[model samples]
Target: MYFEKIDSLNDLKKLSIEQLKILADEMREVLLLKLSSHGGHIGPNLGTVELIIAMHYVFNSPIDQFVFDVSHQSYVHKMLTGRKQSFLEARHYDDVSGFTNPDESEHDLFCIGHTSTSISLACGLMKARDLRQEKNNIVAVIGDGSLSGGEAYEGMNNVVEVGTNMIVIVNDNEMSIAENHGGIYQNLKLLRDSKGKAECNFFEALGFEYFYIENGHDMNELVTTLKKVKDVEHPVVVHVHTIKGKGFKFAEENKEMYHAGPPFDRKSGKYIYPLDNPESYPAVTAAFLMEQIKKNPKVAVLNSGTPGGFGMNAEWRKEAGSQYIDVGIAEEHAVAMASGMAKNGVVPVLNVYSTFLQRAYDQLSQDLCINENPAVILVYLASVYGMNDKTHVGIFDIVMLGNMPNIVYLAPTCVEEHFAMLKWAMTQREHPVAIRVPAKEFISSGKEDTTDYNKLNKFAVTRHGRDVAIIALGDFYTIGRDVADKLKAECNMDVTLINPKFISGLDTALLDSLKKDHKLVVTLEDGVLEGGFGQKIASYYGTSDMKVKNYGIKNSFPDRYNVEELLIENGITVEKIAEDMEKIIG
Candidate 1:
């Protein structure tokens, strides 16, 4: 097998165009074998196989640095760079992460997960190379889907300043996680249709020499085109039109579902893993929003190009029609547009993943929060249950968004409470509301939540006891209840359990009342303790007699972590916290 023969770039360069084509076939076989048993990014990697092979064949990598945009498409690059065993063998599935990691190999320039920052990051590398008086080609391989973000424009704008050898390869597959959105796609279409001879070109407008390849799958064409721009003195963009799901039939037909999903059957190309819970948060949220849109015309659902994360399926998005907006991968634009919609007497619910919403901090603060626009922002996967990648951790929303002025951040513990909070936020017109949805499927309270959220900063005390009070935030409420129960069972202690629904505010009255009976107040949050919910409570009781103990993850980037093990290591478990409590309050 050519793939077995490919030990390094030197081995790759020894192969002819015909041999490289055979190598491409072998690489796809490895990709399919690994992904069929252990699923990962199917479409992106398949599409970029020939492109990456051509890149390795032309450029001297590790010297001629290549930065992938999101690195979801970097699987091919990884395979070519002495890590083919990871893809070829099922046992080595855990050897590498889904995204590019510098720790895994020196060939990977950066550990990137977020999109549209490639050109900008490559600029930094080029600048550093210039400083060191070294001459090497710095290339950024970005997908067409990532072009929707404003950062790509900013990056392209700066690339003109770097008058050196830098290549930006635009892999146009006409698909994002969802289908492409925004006007840039139209311009890209114009460029593609004209076949490199288009007037009013975006790349040319950015002051870079633009080259186009109609068939990006053609290995000969890719190699020839790349060699032309290899030693170019100035910045240039190589726009190549390729298929997203190139090799696999299932991936080619259903690009969205195959973008990234669970393990599948090799022969039939059917998914082997099934959704265990149909009543998941995404499913529930999709159902709720679809029903809401039918009742009110002004009620619009907006997502920052991540419909799957928010549970807005194809059917739901279709039914909503113009009421639904997929603002591409532009969170800042989505947030700002939601604010404008809210200002015009329309209730806009902007749903975004917690990590992606970090991009819109300025818009949330200056545009939405400051104006008191009464828009509902649903921050999904904003807990320890979210993705463990350093770039995409959802645990820092409390640190980033909680302290923002005039924004009401609500944490719902159960499904019923989440619905109640959503209902209230939909109708409320006085202030902007952000609901940090529970990460896991939560058990219902069995009782209707009739509490008025307008009277904000109210803490709901589930059980009353003595000595120690445990205040839980969001999904951690269940953990607090378990700790309280464990304390009772093991230590013969009846500790109080309080679910703090409002993360943006503290219940000062209830906190003051706790001082009378409670000697120690323990705060639990599903986030970092440093700039999060627990630290706010610690700051509140700084001068008080009640000793405050905060239990949560530390301020650091933890990649590919097991949730249960992370909790134990952070002293966030019921047993660990209970043991600490016994030592102090016994």
Candidate 2:
């Protein structure tokens, strides 16, 4: 009744704390109902139900910017902002995106779904407010996982140094998509769990005004905290302790499973249709590699704070215990630490997102690549079609890692091939190997499924034809195959599908061969068009002789995504690619 009656944030101020708590309960029910049916970031939205309410009631929106780090938690904020209907009914394609979008509502300051970006974005907003001489409170609601990022630290340092007027709410649920990783949260946990008597505060050391709220779920406590800090001068970190997946018993119990998920049975709290193929890339790779580490004591799994998501969940963590080192959300530190481990005869497989690896570019180039540390850096979801916000697009990794002197970038088109790439990277002793496991299923390629580390130079051509060379980098390899088959069946055209296993650079011989027979070469990737593996292929073969078409993400900031739509937009659709091939040939 509370939620049905009150549809907007304005109605929030009218309700008492107890009334607001009822609304939170109703909001939680709606989130669970829709997410259990449609599926999305269930735990995150459930956790932030009251926090966003507290935020809206505390700060004036449109004027006072509320920037959320990895804005998936902003669903509650959207609901209170009068966008609940969109989430409940039209969740997939409706106006209300899971993440923050300025276009969706005036309350959303920035369209961010990636972690560790709120502080920097908030600082920018604060600077803009200063220049305009506008009176608006800029509040950044960031997770503890985000604080492990270098960008958050940079922003915090800058804000402190410059004396910017902003409120940085560290929504410390001790959880990211999986259970939260990193030293920052560890320190904060000690601080909160010990009732502020805990020593060695990272925030105070970094010159930030610190206020730790032990109870984040208590609506009254949240309101009091926010009210106390409203429009307060200078930057401050209101480290609020909250439980992720709160209210939902299953979600609360199994934090990792409920982080971000598929449609689940509401009562049973079980996934409706089991992902017949649960992503085996990360887990299998971990299983196979972690086996090697356990066999040989020198091997270690280095996590930049996402080991659980990397398939080394609590069970593995308990099994590996200290062997699977989660270096927190610090990618830079993770990379550097891996390099150090490698230098001392230890094998380190640092699994991180392709996009998040940007933070460790300098370390990768200087520390690991320069010394030729033969570590395995498992780069997951390297392509642009990643459904997360633009800030998390690891699409630029091909170009960024391409120029690295002693690094080999393996773009595995299949899940089995990803393990093969992992095995190969594990064997290399001279230089580091960065394996990119694209978002695609690995069809059974019956060829000796084992890795051939020595033959790292060779590239696999999936199929052969002459009309048009359909080049696919990683996951798009199958997409290319499907398109090529469709073209052959429909248009009386034989198309070649090339799976360039190595996206770092093109196989010159194969590229040169395509020129003579292929009428058109269409390079497809799930990354950015400007600087991607596809564009690299275009540049390599787009000489006057070859008519190469580059299909990828356009030069623009991507909005919140519909996965299928994103692929279609990037020209990754089978029908779309087949149609394009037909038109070009005709």
The residue ranges of model 1 lying beyond 4 angstroms of the native Cα positions read 275-277
For model 1, the local distance difference test gives: 0.90
TM-score of 2: 0.88
Write down the TM-score of every candidate: 0.98, 0.88
Cα error, residue 107 of model 2, in Å, equals 0.9
Q: What CA root-mean-square deviation does each model show from the true structure? A: 1.3, 3.3
Candidate 2 local lDDT, 1-586, one digit each (tens): 7777766667778988888888788889888878877778877778888888898888888677888987878888888787777656744435566677777778877767556888988999888888888777889988877787778888888888767689999888877666566557668878888866666888888877788888888889899989998887788888888888998999999887888887898788889876434446666776776688678777788877666556777777788866788766778889998998998888888888887788788999989889988888888877654545655666677668876777888877666677777776776787788887765554556565554656655556767778688877776677778887787788767778777777665678877777788878888766667876677766776445777788777766565566688776666678877787778778
| Candidate that would win on lDDT | 1
lDDT of 1 at 350: 92
